[model samples]
Target: MAQAARRLGVQMACWKAWECDRAAPQSNRLAMMAGILAVSPSWLLSGIGAGPLELEANDRAALLQELQIASAEAVASQKRVQQIVALLGSVPVAGDSP
Candidate 1:
């Protein structure tokens, strides 16, 4: 849900509120949320359009594997970004007193 909210460009609290029926997203956000969730806006709003598919056992296993691979890749990418940021921090601008 947090990931979905981030992709939708809204705060986690807003997502939680929507989930709990305490508040609703504006029209623009509703549309974006539908896209993020891979559902039609109509279905997301009123449960009357194309909704999510139910995954079979094999499909679920494949999806889990895919998620694991993606998570590992993301961790590696974050590490690389941190290393690059650290290197950049160590480099000095021109005209500095040596």
Candidate 2:
């Protein structure tokens, strides 16, 4: 579970809370969790839909595409953050003034 949580980029306590129904991840994380568990997000949330094993080939392909898009977006976002940090590094910090 610790490894799974780390892979999910969540703390162990947050993962445990999800396990205990004390918290719920947002919808984006729902999709990630489903992929990790080989289930559908609907099933992962409410146990009311087919899981990955039960999905048709088209459904599987669609999910894979969505995951790919999300992965690309995450990479783009990370690059933007790095650029912003680099830009911030060049800004002058002033000394405290009375």
Candidate 3:
């Protein structure tokens, strides 16, 4: 839900409320959410179409592997960004151009 909220540019609380049935997403948001979940919008809205999509075993495995790689890359990228910020912080600001 946190991931969904982040991707949707909504507050986590709002997503939680949606999940908990405290509120519902607008029609436009329904399509976006369905796309994110890989389900038919109609199914998400009313179980009118296929309820939820299921991946084949091999496809699921491949997706899990891809997710793992992406997660690792994201962590590495964050570390690099933190290192760059620290390095920049160590450098003194110049009052005049050379």
- Model 1, 1-98: lDDT tens digits are 98998898888999999999999999999988988888999998789989988899999999999999999999999999999999988999698866
Off by over 4 Å in 3: 59-98
Order of candidate numbers by TM-score, starting with the best? 1, 3, 2
Residue pairs in candidate 2 whose N, alpha carbon or C atoms collide under 3 angstroms: none
TM-score, model 2 to reference: 0.50
TM-score of each: 0.57, 0.50, 0.54
lDDT of 3 by residue, 30-98 (tens): 888888877888988677886665789999999999999999999999999999999998887798444
lDDT of 2 by residue, 1-98 (tens): 89878888999999999999999998888788888887888898778887657678999999999999999999999999999999988776688443
Going through the candidates in order, what is the number of backbone clashes in each? Answer: 0, 0, 0
Q: Which clashing pairs does model 1 show? A: none
Global lDDT for candidate 2?
0.87
1 or 3, which is superior by lDDT?
1
Top candidate when judged by TM-score against the true structure: 1
Best by lDDT: 1
Q: Residue 92 lDDT in model 2?
A: 66
Off by over 4 Å in 1: 58-98
